[model samples]
Target: MSRIVERVRRVRFTWTHLAALVIALLVAAPLYWMAVSSFKGKDEIGANPPTVFADHPTWDNYREAFADNNFGTYLLNSVLVSVIATILVLSLSSFAGYALARLPLRGKAPIMVALLMISLFPTIALAAPLFLLMRDVGWLNSYQGLIIVYTALNVPFAVWILRNFFLGIPKEMEEVAWVDGASPVRTVLTVILPQARPGMFTAAIFTFTACWTEFLIALTLNTADRYRTMPVGLALFGSQFTVPYGTIFAAATVSVLPIALLVLVFRRAVVSGLTAGAVKG
Candidate 1:
C-alpha cells in the first residue's frame, strides 16, 4: 500500500510540473517573439510568414528608436512617475489597511465596499472632470499630476489586498507588543510590519506595475512632448504613412525590462503574499 501511494503521488507531481511548464510557455511565447523581432531588420520584421528568429540580428533598431523618439527622456519620466506613485500608493494603503483590519474603526465593511466601488468606477467618465481640475490647478502635462492620479487609482486595490493579508495575521502578535508597552504606531512598525513584509511586497508589485504600464490616463493628461511617458512615446512611432513595427518592438522590449526585473526580484514574497491572502477575508 505504501509503495502504491508513493507511485501515485509521484505521478501527480509529474503532471503538475508538466501543466505548469505548458502554461509558462504559452504566456512567454509572445514576449519571446517581440524580443527576437526587436533584433530583426525593419524589412525582415514585415515578412509574410514572420521569422521565428532574426535572420541577421542588428542593434540598428535600438539605436534608431532612441535617436528618433527622445526615448531616454521618456524612460526617465516613466521611472520617476512610477516610482513616486508606487511609494505613495504603498504608504497610503498600508496605514489604511492596518486601520481597517486591526483597529476599532466604525463602518469598516461599508468602507471596504465603497473602496471597491470607487475602483470600479469608469476612468473615462472622470477624464473630463479630471482634466478640467488639473487645468484649473495648472498641473496639466506635469509629473505631479500623473503621480497623484496613479496613486488614487491604485491605492484602493492595494488597501484591499493588504487588509486581507493583515487579517490573516494573529492578533496576539500585536497584543504581545502592546503588553510590552509599545503604542499602536510602534506595535505596527516593529511587530506587524516585519511580519507583513510579504504583503507589502505584493502591494508594491501591483502598484508599480499599474503605474508603469498605465497608458490611457498618461496619454490624456500629458500631451506635451517632454512630459509624455514611454507608452505615449511608443504610440507616436507610427504615422499615417508607415508603422515601424521593428522600432516599436525594440522600445517595448526595453520598456518591459524594469517590470520584469521587479517581478523576478520579488517572486518569492509575491507568491507567499498572494497565497496567504487567498485564504483570508
Candidate 2:
C-alpha cells in the first residue's frame, strides 16, 4: 500500500510538471516568434512558410529602427512619463490607502466604493473629454499632460491594493509608534510605510506597466511626432505604402526588455503584495 501510494504521488507530480511546461510554452510562443523575427530580414519575415529561425540573421532592423526616425526621443518620453507617473501614483496612493485603512472618517466606505467604480470606467469613454480638457488648458502635446492623466487613471487601483495591504498590518504596529511619542505623520512616514514596501513596489510596477503601454491616451493627447512614445514610435514604422515587419518586430522586442527586467527584479515583492492583500486582520 505504501509503495503504491508513493508511485501515485510521483505520477501526479510528473503530470503536473508536464502541464505547467505546456502552459509555459504556450505563453512563450508568441514572444519567441517576435524575438526571432526581429533578427530576420524583410524577405524572411514575409516568407510563405514563416521562418522559425532565420537562416541569415541581421541587425538591419535595429539599425533602421533607430537611424531612420526619432526613436531615441520616443524612448526618452516613455521613460520620463512612466517614471514620473509611477512616482505620483505611489505618493498619492500610499497616503490615500493609509487613511482609508487606518482612519475613522465619515463616508469612508462610500468613498472607497466610488474610487473602485471610477477605476472601472472605460478609458475610451474619457478620451474625447480628456482631449478637450487638455486642449483647453494648453496641456496638449506635453509630458505633464500624459503624466497627470496616467497617474489619475492608475491611482484607484493603487489605492485599493495598498489599502488592503495596509489593513493586513497589525494595528498594534502604529500604536507602538504612537507610544514612542511619534506624531501620526511621523509614524506613517517611518513605521507604517516601511513595513508596506512590498505593497508600494507592487503598486509602482502596475502603474508603470500601464503608463508604459498606454497608446490611445498618449496618441490622442500628443499629435506632434517628437512627443510620441515607444508605442507610437513603433506605429510610425509603417506607412500608407509599406509596413516593415522586421523593424516592427525588432522594436517590439526592444520595448519588452525594460518591462521584463522590471518584473523580474520585483517579482518577489509583487507576489508578497498580492498575497498580503488577500488576508484580513
TM-score of each: 0.94, 0.94
Cα lDDT listed for each candidate: 0.92, 0.91
Clashes of each: 0, 0
lDDT of 1 by residue, 78-140 (tens): 999999999999889988999999889999999999999988888888788889989999999
Error of 1 at 224 (Å): 0.2
Query: Can you list the residue pairs that collide in candidate 2?
Result: none
lDDT of 1 at 41: 95
The TM-score of candidate 2 is 0.94
